[model samples]
Target: MSRPRVQFMRRPGRLMLSAVAAFAVVQLAGCGKQAAPDAETTATLIQPVARLDLKVAKAAPGSRSGEEIYQSVCVSCHGTGVLGAPKTGDAAAWAPRIAQGFDTLTQNAINGIRGMPPRGGGADLTDIEVQRAVAHLANTAGGNFTEPPVGQ
Candidate 1:
């Protein structure tokens, strides 16, 4: 019985082509960091969409909900307790302040406490708005406080 012969051939041209292709792929698979935006581009992107003059705006009376006041202004400091401001939802941190009584708290909020600015930095916030925000913060920190109604 005769065995069939199998061909074993090497193509130098094909092997060289494969080697070049593999090298090109490895070279293209480089770990390069992306370049950051230029200063002008960064400035453009960081520019404020609208600049609000809080001072002028403060003169105009307006009613804002407690949650809105908190979100727009109080969150800046209370959210993170910046400069010793009582952090929201922190019962321990708020306990002493809450013990001061709701009226005192609202007064402090209106007059500006040790670290908290008046009206929680929202000069535009009305006295009633500040009271509501104070109630919201105090209530969240375990005090059973009632937020004042709007237009009060």
Candidate 2:
């Protein structure tokens, strides 16, 4: 049993041999300086992807319809009858205001009426855009109206 225990014990000679091999590897890593790559070598290491998107040309300046203006600017308030905007679709809500005639409605819209902001909050809109926007709102409420030009 004592002889078997001695045979099972690890040999220190093998441990020392492994330690020397590890030390030689670490010393070799510290012995050499790395060389820099030439321009061609560097370029070969990194390849760029091609840009494949085609550039789109500009579109012509077209007339802005009343519906376009309403959706862009007025829809925030008028779309859901917010702040007593007379709603875009409810005839009962729009009736009294509609009876006032298109010209009055257009003027009020251009100048800002009661709780409704001017040009439905788009001051940059032309007077014609205001009139056409009113027509669009009025038409949505079942009133017949011709769309005015987006001028002046």
Provide the TM-score for each candidate, comma-separated: 0.59, 0.60
lDDT of each: 0.83, 0.79
The top-ranked prediction according to lDDT is: 1
Error of 1 at 57 (Å): 11
Q: Candidate 2: which stretches are off by over 4 Å?
A: 1-62, 149-152
Q: Write the per-residue lDDT of candidate 2 for residues 104-134, one digit (tens) a residue.
A: 8899998888887777788677777777888
Which ranges in model 1 have alpha carbons more than 4 Å from their true place?
A: 1-62
Model 1: colliding residue pairs: none
Model 1, 12-120: lDDT tens digits are: 6776888899999998887578787799999999999998875534333556778878887888898988898888999999898899899999999999978777777
| CA lDDT for candidate 1 | 0.83
Evaluate residue 68 in candidate 1 and report its C-alpha lDDT on the 0 to 100 scale.
Answer: 77
